[model samples]
Target: MSNDDINARRREQVELNMLTVAAVAGWYIDTYLDKKSCRDSALSGAAYVNELLIGHLERFRQVCRMERPIFMKLCNVIRSKNLLCDTRDITLEEQLIMFLFTIGHNAVNRQVQERFQHSGETISRHFNGVLQAILSLSTQYIRDPSINVPIEIANDTRFYPFFKDCIGAIDGTHIPVFVESHKQAPYRNRHGLLSQNIMAACTFDLKFIHIQAGWEGSASDAIVLRAAEKDGFKVPRGKYYLVDAGYGNTPNYIAPYRGVRYHLREFARGSIGPQDAKELFNLRHSSLRNAIERVFGVIKNRFPILKNTSSHSFDTVTDEDINEPDDDYNTDERRREGNRMREAIANAMCDEYSIHTRRLRDRHGH
Candidate 1:
């Protein structure tokens, strides 16, 4: 074929695809505006196509500058179709954004097929590719902190009276996912369901300093921590990562001193020993390190998807639904088991650390 003919064919494909996508978008907009009521439509298939095509073409000229590949593809297809006639509908940018809105709202390939007049396979392929692109582009937003410690909390007064050097809080949480048989042994949690292990280090401002996702659910919090250390997450001079009892008592990983009362309750009720300055120091350290729990609460609440197990197995499901499969498999029992393991480790560490913190406090006093 001549260059002109090839160009003409490409343009035709673009027009056909955009009209299909716009039809799908219109159905989505109606569904959202209608508040999802039970309904059926009597509109003929041909009429629906004509109406959506006209609507898409009417707005085509205005959205030519969109950078999304899907939108650009739609615009080119529509433009090619328009070459055989006059007047364009739905500009490239509008078509792309509209397509995105459909994917977000509808989230089903069959729905896209019914509304946009494309095969389910075509919609699924296009949708998954676009979703990956969107995620890849947005990854730029999840940045690590530059200074490590925020300026507001850097001064002596802010950390004052209790501890002088504090940086970020560290914790680990289980992200539930479908059991991939190949990795089933490693991914299995205590309760027998599959999950992914994620360890995060967050600062007071909620910015993630370190986030490692995609470990097997069976992995321990300590394992994640060790991996983080191996990956070279720096523990800056004079600053410590506030951790709970799950991690062992090390100079780098500090925990509350046991048998010693903290500010809240350093001296036990039945203790026959005198309440002295040694007791006071342990209390302060425990009080200062509890911020990590709050971080876990906020994250799970916002992304409830993390609270549940994946609905489909990662091994069986396509890439588009991979993240969601983990949420579907979550059960109360699984959640409790995961929570218990994490807490138990933390408490055990605290027991060990309590001994160390008391010794250190006594040494500091001398």
Candidate 2:
């Protein structure tokens, strides 16, 4: 062969040898480890998982952060997809439980290894395996936002018709995180706490339709939201999302009136009610937008990992199933149009509320 051809052949032989070595290394690692830090507990991870799953349904829910049925269903889905398999010593149940226990309780690898009676290497491997499986099933679990008005808005007397086009709510939250010292500046929020910014869109019933996570905590809510929009979060034609003023407004987003009384506390009992159309709109807007806040509360409470810092380098939600966000809409025009829509909706709601109030007054002879 020519000199150039001989070099090419040598390079190909080297690549083949590298692949062979890599395959052998992967197989050996899977089967063996060098003095792996092992945990020995009387209650093996498998036994503990079985006890929790078969003993009491409530206990399972408390530990797994999900009902027994849901947990089993998830296991079935992952196994069916060949995402996990039962090993000789550790069953698939143990694998999933380790993941759930860790994320649900914010347990570190050491804690998880202790509970499961497994080596740190095995624990981390299985944990990552289960996590990847769960992420793969995102399409089935993280459903699409319905284009139609949500039942909560459609059936509620106070919100129906007025918010008939509202399909969901959107908001951003800060999730505690750990980052390298060199990268810590971007992760620090205004309060000087390290965190990641997360923006999520959810239906009125508290189901997340889309999420944009992993932005630095210092990022603005608007910035995260814009990124989410770019990543396939779309508002249906003529549909809008309820947002706090901090989230900003777009043609498909209805932000509560700024510089007005918008908080639920400001409208509590014994406090003066909204006195004008603007205030009325702000009050109702706040009421509806509170759904996003509640969603965050429920999520953080359920996944303590989100509420606290992680032992790992960092964690982030991967919205792999979301589509590329469409940025075709003219933002300036959308804002102008959204303003007009808000004004019209406010006036219409004010008129109807006035009539309803008068009717109540007359019926009660107030």
TM-scores for the candidates: 0.48, 0.86
Candidate 2, residue 271: how far the Cα is off, in Å: 2.2
lDDT of 1: 0.54
Tens-digit lDDT track of model 1 for 1-366: 899999999999999999999999988766544422332345532345445445665343322222234455644654564421121432333334434534334234455455544444444444444445444543465554454444535553324423334567788877777664676897888888777777788776676777766667777776767666655566775456666566644444555444545534424556533344444435444555555566778666644546776343554222321121222223456445534543444454455556766899999994
Who wins the lDDT comparison?
Answer: 2
lDDT on C-alpha atoms for all candidate structures: 0.54, 0.82
> Total clashing residue pairs per candidate?
42, 2
Worst 10 residues of 1 by lDDT: 320-329
| Alpha-carbon RMSD of each model | 16.2, 6.8
Query: Per-residue lDDT for 1-366 in model 2, tens only?
Result: 799999999999999999999999987876566423345567877789879988999898898898989888877987888989999888898888888899899999778777778877788888888878877787688887877777888888778799988888888899888788998998899999998888898888988888788788898887777777776677777778888887656768888788888887988857899899989999888888788899999988998998998876665344334333445544788778888888988999899999999999999999
Query: Pairing residues by index, what is the TM-score of model 2?
Result: 0.86
